[model samples]
Target: MAATEPAGSRHRNEAGPVGDQVRANLKFFRARQGISTTQLARLLEALGRPILATAITKIESGDRKVDVGDLVALALALRTTPNRMLLPDYGPSRGQADVALTPTVTVFPDLAWAWASGKQQLLAAEIALGHGEESPFEVLEEFRRNALTTAERQHADHTAVRAAEAVLSSIRGILDRIDNPVRYDVEDESRARHPDSAARLGPAPATPEGLRARLRSLIAEIDALIGDDSDG
Candidate 1:
């Protein structure tokens, strides 16, 4: 591996408890299902935006910290848990901890669930910013004007748009990911997703273009409620 690679790429390095688990489980499923990164990314795209091969590589290698959202997506992707990824036998742990662990145990679903819930919170927050009257779109215009007039204050519309786009793209990506159907039990959908996300689970379109149209529709409804033509 190259020195430029992240900590996860180094073979000489030891994997902490969670990292080890992710590596093991991803390897297990990828080989078992014979799924390629392109296929997996397609699945991810179905779930939201397009994930690159490198992103998948970083994730599988435990280079990136697997948050709850990542774990949920991974589990949904490979059909396993965060704990199972860390180590095959790891059950859910007792509390929210950030530390080292023994190599023997993997990850717990509860821990993964906690992490996933955190991810959902973040998504919800981003969605909240973009939704209804909170149109980051409208906010951007005001902020930009203020920033330009104020000393050293940037309006941050770019930042806001990026954030909103991320939320929107992720929603699109989730749409792409689920279409492939790794292990989407109705039970899992109800248990694992936010109410809004769960509702969107049924009968997602086959293409991103179609999903974008629906997103536009949702945005239009928001536009009406806010009665503002300019979102940003």
Candidate 2:
């Protein structure tokens, strides 16, 4: 009788296209950032979850599997969003290629990307007709059941706007600190000296200008959604 392969070895032998895409993108992003495996491992450690350089190499080479936690950590360490790491890197022109989301599931790159980015839901017939192709009776009913009331939607819009504004404020604060470190240090010292006089601050912002642009885009998107719902 043949000897059994180790349980951990299953991923290496059974890895599919989705795994392949992830591995390729992992290597691509790491290289794009000019980060070595050792550097990436250190970054992950700084993020509070340590992954050895050898394991990272295995993950990149399709010899290891990446769990959800690792995926998030890798994305953070690489300064990218999780969806960007999960999706395939279609070239500049983004040629019409079918992306395999699962062993039995494949979709056009656009649909796959949209679904991954929370822009659209994956439907049974989407592979054939593309997203928002038709609103069938069941789908319409499902939407109706889960649809937000007008007041609720307006409240959500306001909440989103407020959140975006908060993030923008945080980003501006970070930029200010970077541009005027001496003044920021003095302010920090003052704040430390007088706890009661210190102003509360939001969480640290991600990727400064890029994040600001994304927040603007998200606010615009929320406005568009509200407009579309109102029209409907």
Candidate 3:
């Protein structure tokens, strides 16, 4: 009990053969990776496990006893099997990282999953590779062209949106200025002729209908940019 736990409480799974078994399994994994305990702990943190380097040292030294869940977490972090962690002698034949590794365009470096990102990037890479045998640089060059085209299309769409917004803004400014035309022209004689001219013209109505028509026109221009040929 004291071997598993530091001092106060007894371990449910005491350290006799159980402790030796865990330690042996850990050693097997360590040998396979040639990874130091410190490095392993850092790798775990990188994999979001958050175990301290000191804690890993303790666990490896047989001073800190790990729970079953901890063992599972460690296995997952190391990208290995639970069976491999438990029975180190029966460990999977080396370099599993090499197995999962593949050439891909790293669009979002933070994203780890294969499916949920930049499908076009994956598709483009696959298409580039599928072409009749080419040199490595030639393959990459194909992907680069496709990537650039995709990026340019995205940029053009974004610019189209901004252009439409600018057009609407211009139309609004024109209509607003026309609605309450500022008579900056100083006309002393005209003021005298029309005594209460400010009161003569009641508040101007909003140009919602006219603005809506302009908005529809602007949308049609945008739709054309997006290639909405179905409306034809």
Could you say which candidate leads in TM-score?
Answer: 2
List, residue by residue over 87-201, the lDDT tens digit for candidate 1.
4442223332432334432233433443343321222334445645645556545444543445323332344443445446546445535643442355455646676775575
lDDT of each: 0.55, 0.70, 0.55
Query: What's the C-alpha lDDT at position 35 in model 1?
Result: 89
TM-score of each candidate? Answer: 0.32, 0.52, 0.32
Residues 64-139, candidate 2: write the lDDT tens digits: 8988899899889999878887787653242446787776678767568756653345664455446564566556
Per-residue alpha-carbon lDDT of candidate 3 for residues 58-174, written as tens digits (9 for 90 to 100) = 887888887777787788866776655543241122222211113333222212222222212343345545755766567555644554467655663575664665456546444
Candidates sorted by lDDT, best first = 2, 3, 1
The best candidate in terms of lDDT: 2
Looking at model 3, residue 91 earns an lDDT score of 18
RMSD to native, candidate 2: 18.8
Model 1, stretches more than 4 Å misplaced? 1-15, 89-232
Ranking by TM-score: 2, 1, 3
